[model samples]
Target: MFADVRRRPGNYGLGGTFREASAFVNGCDAGNSWGLLIGFREWLALKLGCEANLTWAGLILKLADVDASLHPSGSNLSATEDERAVEVLFAELDEFLSARKGASDVGRILEKYLRQNS
Candidate 1:
């Protein structure tokens, strides 16, 4: 699956072919950073939704929850602050994932509180 994703030159770029995918895998190996994972998951989630795969959607719904939670606050937040916030979230995610294989459960819990209040 990842190999397929890496082949898209427009997205991954023609130059340094292996670097982006390698970085993404290394990032995942570190037990933190889900930019690629989330992006991939989001795509899968959308496809699942189209196919009526409620189970798959349920698996990744937390990403949506977290995005919504932070949306309003980020509207007024500085880029640096948002970057810091993301770093904190990633750190917390790393801890959570390291503690268990069911890291998505942790993601769901965090998502519930990370969204905009209003």
Candidate 2:
């Protein structure tokens, strides 16, 4: 779902903006009561090599040099920054999901996260 969200946002029902994509993920997570996104943050923190307590959106924004004050919920990034942010987000999600294998995916991801963040 995320692999090509940046290049084809319409297909994912997104508004072709990083903020929209971020919102979509948030909705999905909340819709599942956060269970679905449980391991995502740990996986992302591992990928980023930090335990900054950032959501995936914040982490992506940090990588894009976006100010935390202008986070997705209230972001107003320029088109170029928005696009870069989307690109970074998709790249990170792709890497995180690429390790999918089965029910243990989350456990595997968490293990990696603990190793890196500890």
Candidate 3:
């Protein structure tokens, strides 16, 4: 689903931007279980090593290297941040949709985080 959205967001009536993509993803997650949400939130928290109180969307955006404060104003992602957020969100979803069905891609996100830190 996310892969398709990532590939052709225009087909989804989206501007091919992360803000819209994230909203659509979140809406789907809220409306449907999809079996993918199971443990995914916890996995995101563990991956971030942060409190689990945050929404999975927020965690994913953080993983994408987007600026924080996702809750304060519903993620004020810039053009670059939106692009990165969508990239990483779909990356994580790709793993979830795979046979492994886990957060093995977390290392990839952490690598980006590490590079940023350095």
Candidate 4:
């Protein structure tokens, strides 16, 4: 999923390759000081309403949630912030995917996950 985002065009205005986006999503670099993870989360959310899969969207949102909590205002985050956010994000993703392995459409599953998790 991170690789896919990296391959996409325009950098969604966040700059850097999708690898950088991946880093940002993982709470690294913050993507040019623009809160890349938050931006990616918003982009993913919009995509979710359109054509994204539920499982992937849920995962993206989960990452975004971690990034947002670490850098709520989208400011430039530090390596320590990134590291902490990534740690929490992965733990949450593990828990989330483990519980929803049987779900067919992640979009619907994501909606439910957000409702319950939020």
Model 3 off-target regions past 4 Å?
A: 31-35, 70-74, 99-118
Model 1 over residues 1-118: C-alpha lDDT tens digits? 3334434534644332222333444455566544323333333343334322332223233332334234442333345544443443344334444544565754653344234211
For the record, the alpha-carbon RMSD of candidate 2 to the native fold, in angstroms, is 2.5
In order, candidate lDDTs are 0.37, 0.75, 0.68, 0.42
- What are the TM-scores, per candidate, against the unseen true structure? 0.27, 0.77, 0.70, 0.33
Tens-digit lDDT track for model 3 on 14-115? 997766876787778778765446556655666677655767777887787765674332356677877887888788767755634345554454454455
Better of 2 and 4 by TM-score: 2
Q: How many clashing residue pairs are found in candidate 2?
A: 0
Task: Work out how many backbone clashes candidate 3 has.
Answer: 0
lDDT for model 3 comes to 0.68
Worst 10 residues of 2 by lDDT: 65-74
Model 3 clash pairs are none
CA shift at 5, candidate 3, in angstroms? Answer: 0.8
Residue-by-residue lDDT tens digits, candidate 2, 91-111: 777766677545599888888
